[model samples]
Structures are given as structure tokens and as C-alpha cells.
Target: MTLEADLRGASAATVRGAIERGDPLPGTAGFAGLVDGALVRDVLGRELVYVDREAAGEGASAGARAEANGSASVWSFDPGGLADPELLPAGSVRPLRGDPAGEDRGEPGGRQVWTLPDPAPETDEGAAVAAVRAAVRESVDEVGSTGLAVAFSGGVDSTAV
Candidate 1:
């Protein structure tokens, strides 16, 4: 039995493209980030990501978001551990140079406004089920014997490792 990731499930390259495009939720789970760049959350906003408020500043430009060396000051998947972290918007490709609006959509000052993709069609029920299983197996294997917690909504793309 093999598990295929859901329609939204994406490989590393695919995820990178999606993040650049600001499409729908990434093919993987709920979150993805570029090292030393902007931190991106899933379109569905299923996952929670935090960034340090002080470091991010108010309306920091893309170059200002993270240091030149790509240091993410205080971003974390854990909500409680963040020190004065703010929740990034869902489907937002942030830290742009200035306002994403009223300018070219592509890297205006090193930032892009997130554009949501079309909704996925619900087909391939059998394939989706198989993929679900595969994702679970892979996730468990990656986690090894460590205790893991998964929150699934009976739909694909939610069981993020």
C-alpha cells in the first residue's frame, strides 16, 4: 500500500513555486518557510506560525524582514514559545518592500502579495485515501519512535508532520 499526498501536496520545488506565487495551501501540510526569508503559512490557515514582533517591526521591507544572512529571529511553529510573536496572515507572502498593492506584483521591494489559487476539485477518492495512508506512514517513519500528535479533519492536507 502506497500513500499519495493529496492534490495540494507538493514536492520541495512545487512548494517553493507555490510560495512564490502565493497560491492555495501548499501541497504539504500547513506551513513552509524560506530560510532567512519570509515565513509563509498555508492558504487554509490550518497551521500556526509566529514571528517576533520587535524583529519584524511595523511594515518591515523584504530586505528588512530577516537579516542578510537569512536569520529568522524568533519564528517558530510553537505558539507558546514565541516572545512577542505575531501571527502572519494566511496565504500571505510577506516582508515585501512596501505595500503589495499599487505596484508590480512581482518582488516589489522584495515582497509579493499572496494570491489565492482556485479551489481543488474533489475527485479521485480512492487515490486520496491511498495518499492519506502513505503520508501517515511517511510522517511516522520520519518522527521515529517519538510520540506524535496529529489533528486531522477527515480531509487531506491537514495531517502535517
Candidate 2:
């Protein structure tokens, strides 16, 4: 079963279309800042669970394992709310592959190849600043809210916002 939760803005529309068409997971670029949370099952039952990187620890239990990818960790799903579940080693378990409904795409999880944006910046500070400014402007325009709030930590990134 496909499940999406608290999707907002452009993604809410685009993903809704994909879901309606029974399409595999759609491109996620449109969801950059608007996805409050989302969980969707690919045709093979591989669930893509989105959680805040900051409070991710709160979702873990003794039986859950955390797979580190770069600076982020993907926590395994706990079958029950019990304090202790069978914790597999990090990276030991892979997402289940294949579609039970007989729609196999010859790929793991029957997932679609979604295009992603190239987030790399050119080697120019001025260009980087301009790009950031334009992105911020676009976000503000999309928000269309009279009130604005920033999750500030008084860091350089926060100050830039």
C-alpha cells in the first residue's frame, strides 16, 4: 500500500498525480522544503520513510538499528512499539525487492528512475549568492504568508536565511 503523509505545496500536487496514476515514486526535488513528512511504499513494499534529521533519535528503540550514510542515518523500522526489537547491524538489511502484485520492473523494489536536480554550485561566490537569493525569493513567493518563521540556531546558515 502507498502512503503519503503531510505533503504540502508542489509535491502535494505532483506526488498526488503519481500516486493516482499508480506511478512509482516521483521525483522528489519539488519537495525540498514543503514535505512536512511522507512515507510511501514502492511496488515491492520498500517503504521510503522521511523523518527530521534532528529528532530522528526519538524514533529509535533498542531493537532498531541506524545505518549511517554520510552525516545522516537511516533507522530501521521497529515492528512494534516495544522497548527492544531485534536490532540488525547497520547496513546489514536492504529494502525488500520485487512487487507482490506482479508488476516487477526488473529493478530492486520496482522503483522508477527519478531525475534529481544537480545541487552543485559553480566555482563563483557571486553566483552562489545570487542562486541562494533567488531560491529564497522563490520560497517566500510560494509561501505567500504574511508571517514568517525561521528555525534559527544563530549559525552561519541560519544567519544567511
Candidate 3:
């Protein structure tokens, strides 16, 4: 049975709510119905989109489903360590720490942002520092940058970076 057949008569909100409630629907093996469609399991034993019901019904198809998920994909990863390296290509970048809203700081320019791997280690302070240092070194080496500027907003991560 295909995902569409399983969700053909279901509403997006209903499917999403089932996933949120951890209630797996039929014809879904290690998969869950998201707001869009069924999330199929990937080679890395991760669940990706088997079929994007929203896009298909809307007559849209161009980019991969991964891009459509965006930040929502973060939920696919286990809440402990980094995601499998293969899932995240080499050179993929993301925040070293903290949320994207930059709510941890008050002043606008006071927040610090460091681009690291998408799924960073939960408590690996040493790894975080090393990633930042490597990024700085790479920038200086490749671009011959004479000076560097880091935004410090009194946050522990910002200060460390």
C-alpha cells in the first residue's frame, strides 16, 4: 500500500497530528505522516519524505523534499549526538550553538554566530571551539584576511568563540 492510498482521505492537519501523537498509520513502516505527507525511511535508517502530498496535489515538483522540510528536518535526528555525516554533506554549515532568533542576547549586534555542522554535539564544548578555530583559520588562510571580528554579547558560547 502506498502513502497516498493510506492518506488519500485524510487532511494534512490530521496526518500531522497523528505524527505528533506518535500514532503510526497503516502502510507506514518506520514512517510517520507529516503535515505534508508520509516520511519514508532513508538509507541511513532515517525517515525522509516518501511522497509530498501537499506538493503533488498543488502540482509542484522541482527541489528535493529535504529542502522543503528545512528546520523541520531537525526533528528527524536523535536528540543526543550529531546526525550521520553522510546525511549531512561535507562543508554543510549551521549554528554552533543557541537558537536562530538570537533571543539569548538583548542588543541587535551583540549576538555571535558561528557556522558549524548541522547536527553539532550536544555537550562537546571542545569540539565547538575547535570548529570555530578551524573556520577562522580556514578563512584567514584561503582569503588572506588580515583581521577577524567576532560578535560578543556576554553569552558563554559567544565569549568562548
Candidate 4:
């Protein structure tokens, strides 16, 4: 079977099993399959990790690594009644929900905390297109380089952007 067919045939359970058994899958680029309308990967190639609904809260190791490296930051739109920002130290966990009224806001302590409005829905195709164009322009401006590199995965979202 083709790679796409193999990916389509693989289930989350099967991928998780492979991870547990420390077995390597053939594809270098990860696969994205729709699970309840959310694009999810059975394996994350760089980290060789598997994530699904059941494994959502399984980022403790990544979090720990970030903390160890002092590169941890939390980006959220709403502080969620967090009056004392000091309560959240660097590498602390924060939940994301709701929308911000206006521009993004940030607070820094042990970890960097950024609160920005939730992204507009994908239904707003024009807005999405404009945002991506603006981002590309800004990125190119900052880089001040002739060529632009896009870490593309031949996925719909990256391709569209």
C-alpha cells in the first residue's frame, strides 16, 4: 500500500502501541487525520511521540524539558481570574479559553505569559488569508533576506497560508 494508505489505515491505538514498543514507523513526515474535526497526528516525527484525545495531558515531559532549559512560556488570552501573576511562575501550566476584547497582553515572571485573543475561525477565509500575508511580510521584513523558507508539510493549512 502507499504511504497515505498506510497512514489512513493506522489508528491512534496502533500508533500508541508502536510508541510503547519503541518501534519506528516508515514515514519521516507525520500524518494528520481528522479526529472529531480536529487534525491530529498519530506520531510527531521530531519527538517521536504520539498524541490523541486520550494523551492530551501527556505533555509533562515536554514541559519538564522546557523548564529545565529555562525556555518555558505560557501564551493565553485570558488570565482566567489570575489576579496575582506571581502565582504563576516560569514553566507553570495555564489553561487557554475565551476571547480577548482587544490587543494581546503579556506578563512575565518565571515564564513568559502572553494573552492574546483567540484566533478567528477558519470560516473567515479572507481574514485568514490577509493574516497569513501580513505575517509573511512581517517575517520577511524581520529576516531582511531575499529568500523565504516555509517549513511546509504539504498540508492544506500550510499550503493555503
Candidate 5:
């Protein structure tokens, strides 16, 4: 149930064995853009990530890579960021880019580098709800009494927090 504001910190910390994501939330979920120009959507697809329809695609020049690189110009978790955005596939990882420092190709859905692992396997409906509730509650418990005000956007993720 981490807020989008927290993603900056969480994403910054998720490199290999040194993740510092806030808890009682366990492991990870949601959308995160790595410093290495990779875009990741969580296995649950709980958070939506989108790429500009015109900006989506694979095989481009280095210049196009710089322009994409999972930066604000090419990707947004909120669909409103683009006039027409393509919902990034769930549990997927891809680079929003082109070739190195050269010709720019206008394409969509760039080459996928990795598909995030699904750590939470399929479970019974009730069990799934319980698990989700537990994770969210753990996160809420940590954040609720912090005495800092949080802005709620009324989205399912923010509302849960």
C-alpha cells in the first residue's frame, strides 16, 4: 500500500541485495523505473504503467534510447500522461528505448528484457484476499501514525494506504 510518492525512494533503493523499501510491506509490487533504463510492472499488476502510444516500441538508435530510458517523457504510471498510452504488460520488464546516439525510430512496445517473477502463486480467492489484506495492513500500520500528512488521491492504492 505504499503511495506513489514513496516510489521514488523505493525505486532508488531496489538494486540487487540492497533494497530499502518501507515495511510492513513485504518484498515488492507496483511500477518502478530502474536507473538502468528498465521499466517494471509488478506481477500482480496492481499498479498500472503506460507508455506513450507514439513512443512505444523496440530497436532504436542511441538518441532514441536517451529520450525513452523510462523517463517521464516516455513512461507514466498514469495514463493521462499521454494522449494515447499503451498499458505496459503486467509482470513485464522492458526498456523504452532505441539504438545508441543515432537515428531515432518512432515505435511502440520496445524490446522486453525481463518478465518479473511471480513470487505469489495462484491461491484460493479467500486466501488471496487475506494475504493482500495482511500486506496492506502491515504497510498501513507503519505509515498511519507517522504524524506526517499524506495526500490521498482516492485511487484504490492510495485509499488502501
Candidate 6:
């Protein structure tokens, strides 16, 4: 199983647990940190979606059933993650549940916003630094030997890696 996200809270751990439990999706906030997110099937034949609850038009869909963000006006249930406006024509409108104020009713849409716990304060700064150095060194060595390629865009994350 593979996950892609700039996760916060217990999201990474939660994903690990979900993989161990053989669950597709572990939690919703596990998806909150994503930007320009979309659902698609990977080469391994696994279906994945990235949904940010606060976003207007993002949700996870497996075939006919889709959970869309309440604010979204136009949505696509594309399995290939390519929702290009010019290439792909408009998809059918699948309305989500809402109140008079247009707030998300949740569920049925499979929208569950998880409140993550506050991160524990860091101690043993030197040890933490050393651990990070060791991990990064290991990663660099492995990537060097394997000839690695990253999805780089000169961002902080890409550069740091």
C-alpha cells in the first residue's frame, strides 16, 4: 500500500494502521493536508483519492458512489486522476446532502472530519537531530544505489528530500 500526503497529527500512523488492517481509507483529516487533490487508480490497480474537507470541489469516489465537498459546484469522478476541463467533458451532477445553509450533512457521502490530537512536545533535541540525520543518510544511500527519481518542483519538501 502507498499513501501520498503532507500529513499532520496522527495521520501517518493512522495510515500505517489502516494498511495493517487492510482498509482503504483510515480517516478524513488524514486527507486534509492535500493540495490540488484528486482520486485515481495507480499502476498497481489501487484506487486512491485525496480530499480536503475545506475545499470546494474535492471528494473520494469509487465508481457511482461519491462524497463531494459541499462547496463544490462541478465535480468529476474520474478514476485516472485526470480531470482536465478542456479534454474531458462535464460529468453528470450528483448532488450532495445539505441543510438550508448548505452545510455538509456528512455520511452517505462518507465525509468524516476527524479531530486530530495535539502533537506531543519534543524533548531530547540532540537525539532527535541525530535520528533525523541517520534516517536521511540511510535514505540518500538507498536512493543513490537504486537511482531515485522524485516528483520535484523546487518546493521545501522536494528540496529537503
Highest lDDT model number: 1
Of 1 and 5, which scores higher on lDDT?
1
Per-residue lDDT of candidate 6, residues 13-125 (tens digit): 55445434545445433222211121222112232333233223453321212234332322233323333221111111112233222233333333322223456765989
Candidate 5: list runs displaced more than 4 Å. 1-9, 13-26, 57-72, 98-161
Which lDDT values do the candidates have, in the order given?
Answer: 0.51, 0.36, 0.33, 0.32, 0.48, 0.34
lDDT (tens digit, per residue) of candidate 1 on 40-97:
5567677666666655554543332333455555454554554466776766554333
Q: What would the per-residue lDDT of candidate 4 be over residues 30-123, giving only the tens digit for each residue?
A: 4332222122233332222121211223322211111233333222112231221122231121221121211122221111222223555778
RMSD of 4: 20.1
Candidate 5 structure quality by residue, lDDT tens digits, 3-46: 33423324534522232232222355544443345455554456
Q: lDDT (0-100) at residue 147 of candidate 6?
A: 57
Q: What CA RMSD would you report for each candidate?
A: 12.5, 12.3, 21.1, 20.1, 10.2, 13.3
Instruction: Give the range where candidate 5 is weakest over 10 consecutive residues by summed lDDT.
Output: 15-24
Which residue pairs in candidate 3 collide? none
> Which lDDT tens digits does candidate 2 get at residues 33-57?
1111222333333333333233233
Which pairs of residues collide in candidate 4?
90-110, 90-111
Q: How accurate is candidate 3 locally (lDDT)?
A: 0.33
TM-score of 3: 0.18
Q: lDDT rank, highest first?
A: 1, 5, 2, 6, 3, 4
Model 1 whole-model lDDT (C-alpha atoms): 0.51
Residue 85's lDDT within candidate 6 is 22
TM-score of each: 0.42, 0.32, 0.18, 0.21, 0.42, 0.28
Off by over 4 Å in 4: 1-45, 49-120, 145-161
